[model samples]
Target chain A: MNFAFTEDQMAFRDAVRTLLEKECPPEVVRARWEGKPTEVWASLSDMGVVGMTAPEDAGGLGMDELDLVLVLEECGRAALPEPIVEHAAVVIPALREGGGKTAQRWLPMLAAGEAVATAGLGEAPLVPDADRAALLLDDHDGCLHAVEMSACELTPLDSIDRGRPLFAAAWYAEKDTKVEADFELAFDRAALGASAQLLGLADRMISMTVEHSKEREQFGRAIGSFQAVQHRLADALLRLEFARPVVYRAAYAVARPGECAPADRSLRVSMAKAYAGDAATDAARAALQIHGAIGYSWEFDLHLFMKRAWSLAAAYGDGSFHRRRVGDWLQQREDSDA
Target chain B: MDLTYSAPEAAFRAEARAWLDANVGPFRDASSNTADGFAKLREWDRLLFDARLSAVSWPEEYGGRGASLWEWLIFEEEYWAAAAPQRNSQNGIFLLAPTLFEFGTNEQRGRILPKMASGEEVWAQGWSEPNAGSDLAGLRSRAERVVEDGRGGWRLFGQKTWCSRGAFCDRLFGLFRSDPTAERHRGLTYLMVDLRAEGVEVRPVQVLDGEEGFAEVFFDGAFVPDQDVIGEPNDGWAVAMATASSERGLTLRSPGRFLATADRLVELWRARGDRSDPAVADSVVRAWMDAQAYQLFTQQAVSVLMAGEDKKMGAEASLNKVWWSELDLSIHEAALGLLGDEAQLDSDWLRGFEFALAGPIYAGTNEIQRNVIAQRLLGLPRG
Candidate 1:
């Protein structure tokens, strides 16, 4: 009945927050906004944050979902452009579920910051060619196939989030390098990752809005003094807070996948995506609105978060898509009784 | 570090589950879905009270099983898993009973506790007023000092709105402005008023779910004896907050109840062959996860309270209130979204949809909860 974080969990959260504040400060985040930095991603890997969800035996941090969520929230708040979500949330879980000698090999590399990996969950119409990463996990024939990016044709698209470039890649599984019965789990993990990313983006946007509102003045008072502005900021804060637990809960479920029933887990992942996606989008939009004309200019960093939120919102599934999914789940329950 | 229950608690869970299995019927059976559903539910509550299953966390002096908080949670988990009937005396059991334990006189406890536990008396909250919804401190419900044959007490003459179950309840505990000249919140007093008093009237308000769960109660000089007062005269706010803190803080329902419903949701999804849609499955899974987090959060809160750390309940309960209400809404909204147009057509599903719609508006509103978190938990600057 105690919702307060344990001392260990709090210490872990503080450590992560401190690390992000020190190493990946706002300047580094801003730099990543202009161009992707392999070094920054590598630094996170070196710190063991990149492989937070990976097994301890695999040279990973072996942290639970809540730990990862705490880290991700800090990363989001700081607007740090690390591939922790890509590496930890997507790649590690996908590999762990894939399991075998392949996992034994890849998990260590992924955990050690030696290899950069990302998952393509068929979220978009065009597939991401794994050219930017060492490996690509794809959904093919109802099974997630892990393949080398060297064999695929990689093409970078003009994505909304310039900070994190999106590359569409085509890969052929010439031989079954590794096949797993966890397309759903991989999808959930990927969605959870997207949710984490959205949370970070939303949180940063809220902070930016709050700070800017306090400093920016109109009618001889800080714009924050205005009830309209205060209410908007409050609403954004609420959305971010609400989305936060959903992302963490989803990650927790994934960590102890058995703790949740399969359907329940699936529903949770979807709701997290839906809520986090919408929250991120809304917060970004509100942030931009609060900033007025200044936010629309490319000179400001607000666009970076706004674009990231937009991209992430569409990454796993949009609000309408998830909402419909929720509706269908409800209808199914009614039909069962009949 | 270990969140697992002790052996005794586990044993209690099994016993409770077995008892519930034999005694409780399916929750939504046709016969139990009528307007008198609360009465039917009260019967089950009385049975549980007789069996020492009701108010398990309350002290033995208050007619409870005097179980540990962990054991109480386990009892709830197993009870919900068995699809036990809803307790009609929940308002009294969850809120008033805890408040009485903390602030009530021994005489007050002796008189009220047993009847509440046995479901013989239903109690309702009389907090909100016409102008005081979220701003509860601004409540104008007046209680003037009155003389009854040289003995002094308060005579209540004001209106209260959004009083859930007030129309049906036998008694109400509420706040009133005892000192009109004093500033808002300074003059308030907590009084236990009989709903069946000579000058009292209760008018039910129909909600979106087509249920009259809430009511507006008017008092025309309704007499509340001095002995029935909770705590000091002007300290009603503290008592009210204590009651609210507990009500919002603890896990009122069994985690197993939500989990069961979530499982049924998935089963329905599969039955309709909607599992193929990754989008729908994802939303369902997300709802379930949110529910789990809520359950975990509630469990944590219960543990804290049982360990006699009631002060932490103030901020933590606000968190629980926000999270659970939003989760409830999200689960149903996800359900409605998945069902598409068909959701609007189905009565039961529609009721769930309507209930979800009201989630944010009730229990002091998610907006207010966030404000409390910002002002109280985070120490944010409030203008």
Candidate 2:
């Protein structure tokens, strides 16, 4: 009956927030965007942010996806440039499912933050952080294979979200490759993780824009005081607020899949991805509109969150793709019922 | 966090479902806008009161089980899912009763709540004037003190337009100017007047659907005893704001109504056989998602209330009103979009579309809600 986070969950979230506040400030995020050798990954690894979702037998914290969702939101708020979500939420879960001699060899290293990984589970053509990842988890014939970066050829590409380096990786089966159990579930988890990130990014954009509106004056009054500006900001807040619970519910749906129908699970994930995608875009657009010209510039930190919003929104299944999936799922449910 | 009900809540839901299953029946007239339909709805309300299902969250003394907020939400879900008759006394139970509980004297609650819960006295809100639609502070209704035998009460005079359920309502609750020298929003008094009193008039106003769901109430010196005053004589603004919060918040628009609406829309979409069109499917899915969002958001708000966090309710109420109203509007629009011109022939969707049109406009328009969010929640400067 209760939807509020438990005391333990709140404390864990606060811990992640504190770590990101100290480790991934604007300068650090900028450095990561500039292709600098940043310590953000190692710092997060030290905080167990990289392996919180891995199983206990895999030498990780053995946390749930809800916990991972909490941490990912902080990563989004900080606009942290590391592949923590890829490493923890996607790769580790996929590797755990594809358990074997291959998982045993890499699971400890990946779970212990000894290496970083990127997942190519999305329908998007590009894989994020492929250039920086030591390991690549790619899809082949609807099954996942884990391979070393050296086993793949990556053609680098530019993304609007510079913090995430994108590449089209032609992946080949390597020594540690294995078929994963629950491949579809793994993909749903990835999209849901991205949804959580977008929720965080959207919320961050809202606060930053609100703060900007209060500080920025136009025609002898704060621009935020204007009804037009206020309404747009209100719309942004509305979308984000509504999108958030769906994202959390998606996380819950993923965490307890056995308790839910498969169609319901996928539908919930799609709902999260689609809603967060649209909401984050709206928040970013509203932030830009509220900031006027300064938000368009690279000098303001607002662009960092906005670009990340655009990148993450399209990275996982985009809104149109997920919405269609939802429609199809519900239609199937109706047919079965009939 | 767990979204499933606890054991007691589940039991309560089952009890309500069972009672409703046994006692509730479909409307013979299927329209609550007409006089006969209104009487039928009032009878149903009385039936629900007798079953102790009218206001589950209120105290036992006030004809309720004194259940928790979660239980009330559960009861609402079952109530709506069963397609039970609408609450005819909602104006009294949800809108006015919260204010009464918060500000009324013990005597006022003891006298007023039992009748309200039992549907013996149906109430209507009298907030808007001809000149005071969105800006309620500009209302010119006045209530002057009249003394007799060393005891004094107020004589109310002015017009209150857009009074929901005014035609059949037995009582009126509204704010009036108590001091001529005071400015807007100041020196106002919240009064409860008997609609049957002398010098009072109730004229029905036809809504867009050609239904007499609303009316304009005129008071040519309608008498309201001192006992009917909600709060201090000149501090009605704050009292009215309390009621306004209830009107805009969870009390008025429970998640159950939207859930039922969404479920119906899904059924309609399925029956329409347009799933092959990707655009159609996308619209249906979006509607379902919006309903889920609202349900979860309301649960979150209820959780906050259970935790005794009252400060966030006001802004959250405003956000909630905007969210549900827009969601309801879009769901109806999607239904019509699916049917196209056939929407004119289907009475269900047609009536739904008509009623939903008032969502954003009433309980303060969505525009005013945004202003509240921007200034109060976002801390944006007031324009």
Candidate 3:
């Protein structure tokens, strides 16, 4: 069984990485804290990344989850303040599945970057980028709905990750808002996207820690030379490496849904989300430990990735919830085997 | 990337499963740790070799199917699913054979491989000495050149401990000090020594299970011919690294065994039903996830290798070693906790926990692997 990405996927990933490095540098991320313009989002949208996963018939690029995950990873690496993941991974899929005048109306808006959308489908109590979103896709009572942000009551909530603004909102949907697809699968897609982001963040955190460890001298030598510091970073690397393939597998399952059973796909997504959350936490902790006081400070670039890691670790079904999901499915599998 | 096997691979798997279903006995006998049991395992290996299943991925000339890495993984899955006996020749087939293919001369391969594949000569690794465990270069084992019967050879004299299956193994391979004045790693020479040779001794070292799972081999003047030398005489470190790579990589612990153990743990947890605690369930879930992760990582490695790309695992191998060993321990510990007071009694969980405890300590202890990851992989300066 081959697990190598296609050359085109690799090229696309590189292009997205180049784009993010140029448009969403650390300073650009820092500008979001001061309420910067949404120019970066516009640029990303101009590059057609916002609607990468929407159906071509729905005025989008019609890319699959695998392709979208690449862009989401870049967004996480840059700690991008925009809701590209929500737009491409969560909102687009929900709207496409909703497939009515509601989807037809906003799909073009989202595809053209004229409107931004965020989904409150995760277990998180708050919705991210809710103030800037034109549409809000909410999951309630096992039903998914695409509704306008203005129609919902919003209460701004401060998150540890200041880059992505969060708000606690109560959504009200009319008769035509409900989507006719498996909302569970839609949630898996969202969680899988979050997992991809976490993987990317962990990867970036490790790179930063490694660089810091090599440069930061203590007692006449770089701290990385110390076995204790090295071991902590190495442990972080292990977690990130293992978590990465799980995230990709989840993305693969989502992109090619017919290849796996629904329950199996759900279980895989849970594994990915659970493992990525834990790995990213390990990475953030190690980064902080390696960078010492600087990592914990607001002035350092490390906090940008660390806070997002802390935020995403609890987003879209925390580690324990996803682990429970996995346990239940395993129990079911055991019962079937017996 | 595809996870599904190709048509030929699927057919090969079906063939393997059919043969195993017909030939395999009950779950591997626990008694297989004994000398008699090992003999039975050797017979089983012969049976597999006759069917060209012993070395599924080995070249055809060496009595194998010459299958791809993917096919080999599939074969392992099917083989383990059938609860087949352990491969008595694994140390030879998996570790040494790969090195032989990489570094051995044509003559060496011709003489050594056929017997190894057929289990006519079971091999043990003699890398660890009493003085050299984690730091293998500290080994004082020496092999001095000699002219025996007008032929160039070396006389081995030293001790090698922690050789798994050494008590009954017919041959062993390891590094020796070829140049006394040379530095730690430079003077080493990789040699294939016969355990049955004169002045050789094998003393069993009983493990916690009260079985002679390993042994300490002492050489008084064990003779190894010049042809037995692998790679150059003084540049054996590179050769040893290749074997060590196999030892730490996919060869030493294939995903099939871990997957099987995870399955067993799940079954045990499920049998409790209402008695299944949430904590235990969570641990089981993590174990299952780790096993799947290991499987997927291995698939990715195989896929990359198949694409003709050499992704040096290096420290990543250490990461894998630590991950699987800990995962194994956690799974067993969870099962034992589920068993509660009954864990005091003899059970698979107890045996598994005992075995898994050695996993981190062996194959260059998990601590050493972490050091490698930190220093070699993370670019951490050596302390």
Ranking by lDDT: 2, 3, 1
Interface RMSD of the predictions, in order shown?
Answer: 5.2, 1.0, 1.0
RMSD of 1: 5.3
lDDT of 3 by residue, B109-175 (tens): 9999989989899999999999899999999999999997899999989899999889989999999
**Residue B179 miss distance in model 3 (angstroms):** 0.6
lDDT of 2 by residue, B1-383 (tens): 87666688778878888998887875533456678888888788888889988888899998999888888888888877777766778889998999998999999999999898887889998999999988999989999999867778998888999988899899989999999789888999999999999979999999888989899999998888899999999999999999999988988888888887778888888887476787777777788789889998998888888888562377788999999999999889888888877877957777888889989899999999999998998999999
Instruction: Please identify which of the two predictions, 2 or 3, would achieve the higher DockQ against the true structure.
Output: 3
Fraction of true inter-chain Cα contacts (below 8 Å) kept per model? 0.16, 0.93, 0.90
The CA lDDT at B58 in model 1 is: 77
**Candidate 3: fnat, from 0 to 1?**
0.90
Arrange candidates by TM-score, highest first: which order?
3, 2, 1
Model 2 stretches with alpha carbons more than 4 Å out: A174-176, A334-338, B309-312
What's the interface RMS deviation of candidate 2? Answer: 1.0
- Model 2: number of backbone collisions: 0
